[model samples]
Target: MDTSTSKVYHVDGYDSRQYLEHYFSDKPDLTFKDDTLIFPIENLTKIFKKGHIKGDLMIDLSTGSMIHYLLPSCEFFKRILVLKVKDRCILELKRWLDTRTGAFNWGHAAKLHVDIAGNSDQLQDTEEKLKSAVEHVVKCNLAKENMTDPIVLPPADCIISAWLLDNVCKNQDDYIRYLRKMSKLLKPGGHLILIGCLEISYYTVGKDKLHAFSYDEDFARKALGEVGFVIDDCKVKKRKAQSDLADYKAIIFIAAHKVK
Candidate 1:
């Protein structure tokens, strides 16, 4: 029930997916009718192409909706490491990867590893659930791992996180620490691409009353710079929906590279 550490919460014994479905059912603005989410996929594709992510090892730090958008394009990677801070996100990603007609390209030789942390559930059960959803042809290794602890991450050529920094970090120092940790996971010349909300309230996992840090683009750029990352290209856009009656404007999309 603790919002800080626990990644998932069950309501009426239903799983996280069921909880989300029920929570979003009443929200007119949040719609999941299509295969993809609300974000502009065309813009993401352009950013990916500009970042030159092909044939490189990629690590998705907080793979939320970005997983749905980027998985198909990531076929060229030698290996892809998806670190989902929330259990439900991991399950959703696993479901997508397991499907035969999903965005996943089975022809790729890349290995898929899904990491989940901040959950009270058994690790084995989580792994089994992921395994059951996966297709037989896709070469994937599923496991439950904690992101806060020291992890032997694969050498990634690029690290991409979408809407992660603002949610996980408690303050500026925590944000810096996260950036440093992610930098350590990347290769010397690897890049870090982040698409996040600049200043938005937290509304996910059935907690509609939660609040998040008011993120600023300048602070984020400075944080990346302090961690020896050069700002290659950055773009900020406001995401608005007619039915969404939120006070804050959504600032999305940012990309940076590690300084050699």
Candidate 2:
């Protein structure tokens, strides 16, 4: 009788929400007091203004969940092309961008393009939410898809990848390849701005695990140099995380130029 013991199981919804929130929400450190995520936009605006990114066309790779929310604040770009690594983000971003009541003013706006490449296994549900929000969207993969190859891209004044390279790229070669591909997307003497987390560990979304690479100012300069991009001025800003459990507490922003 002693050998046969009953086992009790308990479930805590708070813990479950905490775990789920970790993946679904933005990094704790990246959030602001106003409840508005403005770091990416602020960083992009800083670089664009500093680098003089005014041009006829602008391309944004991996437009994150909040890009369209901040686009209106940036008045330099005449036309914006958003290339999302995952289809869901593209759909969500497009919906937000097209919404008249949304953060971005879509009424008096320039052309907006959305390219959906590769499906994200981690954020599938979120992707679905995004897909339902948009009508005109392109589906393709950034690595294998040839439809929108940046190499043969039409002349553009500038190209921007907001916190994208470090996530998709695995190693140095991958980074270089991405840079080269992006270089072909820009016109001569164009600029490229990369904003990423430095020394970050793995993050999870739902049940999926997303790995973060260690990228800093030096890494940006070196990688951009190999791809024929000149290091103009890299501004490193210290970003901190509010959660004590988080491994990474800070991040840096890198701004560089592509030379002819």
Candidate 3:
């Protein structure tokens, strides 16, 4: 009953399958029927389909074992580099990529993606495209100076961080640090897309609760500006208490350009 208390869990041994099942689903309540739960992703998917992001390579920081959001980007970028904080997360992603027997099912999210694009027929083709675009699913630590060191990656045309920064950082300062780190991963003038929680203190993964930074739109815009990025687009959808997944007030989606 005490939701206020939360303990951070390392990505190494976390139950990724369980986490995936709880969040992404075909169930309308948690999926297509609810805009708050699905809008952030829907909005991103639409943008990618429209070719908002450019370049041959796209890099995603802290993919968190979910490929639903990346489906759209797969079409535009020939190569994608997805990084996860824990090796376990990277492994979780690979299981799906490998099409293992027990891999997490993303039918619901995929369906939603096509639904938003108004092209239900391309479901299977779109799924295959996503699988093909992802060239690397590797380990990463945003706190480090070199986010993906030991494996120097080429500068990206665009970068995306979805709910990873909010979950990893303990405070506003940490958020700024990671934002700067993420910005550096992109080429100058490259765009940065972020999907994050707004004013949320904690989120649950299975039975365990985890810490999250509670930040608003003002804080987000300022943080991006202070770190030398220009905002191109930002979308904020109010959060609905449909589930106890997290106590967030809203979800903020931002597309910004890194300063040269």
- Candidate 1 residues lying further than 4 Å off, grouped into runs, are 1-40, 63-66, 100-151, 204-207, 242-247
| Alpha-carbon RMSD, each predicted model | 10.5, 11.8, 2.2
Per-candidate TM vs. native? 0.65, 0.66, 0.92
Local accuracy of candidate 1 as per-residue lDDT tens digits, 1-260: 33453231111111435434532222444443111133423444566555365545777665342343353344445556666655555655565565524433311111111111222334334333433322221111222233434545667787777656665566788678878878877888787877666775544444332444566888888888998998777776665443232234565566677774
Candidate 2 residue runs with Cα over 4 Å from true position: 1-36, 68-74, 100-140, 145-152, 244-246
> Which 10-residue window of candidate 1 scores lowest in summed lDDT?
107-116
Model 3 regions more than 4 Å off? 1-5, 9-13, 31-37
lDDT of each: 0.52, 0.50, 0.77
lDDT of 3 by residue, 1-260 (tens): 45566765443334677666656655545532354337666778767766657789899885368787787677678899888887767788888889998787878778777888788999888777888899888787665699777888888999887878787778889889988887778898998999887888877767777787888999999999999999988888876556667778877899999885
lDDT-wise, the better of 1 and 3 is 3
For model 2, what is the alpha-carbon lDDT of residue 124? Answer: 25
N/CA/C clash count, model 3: 0
For residue 5, what is the lDDT in candidate 3?
60
Sum up the clashes in candidate 2.
1
**How many clashes show up per model?**
0, 1, 0
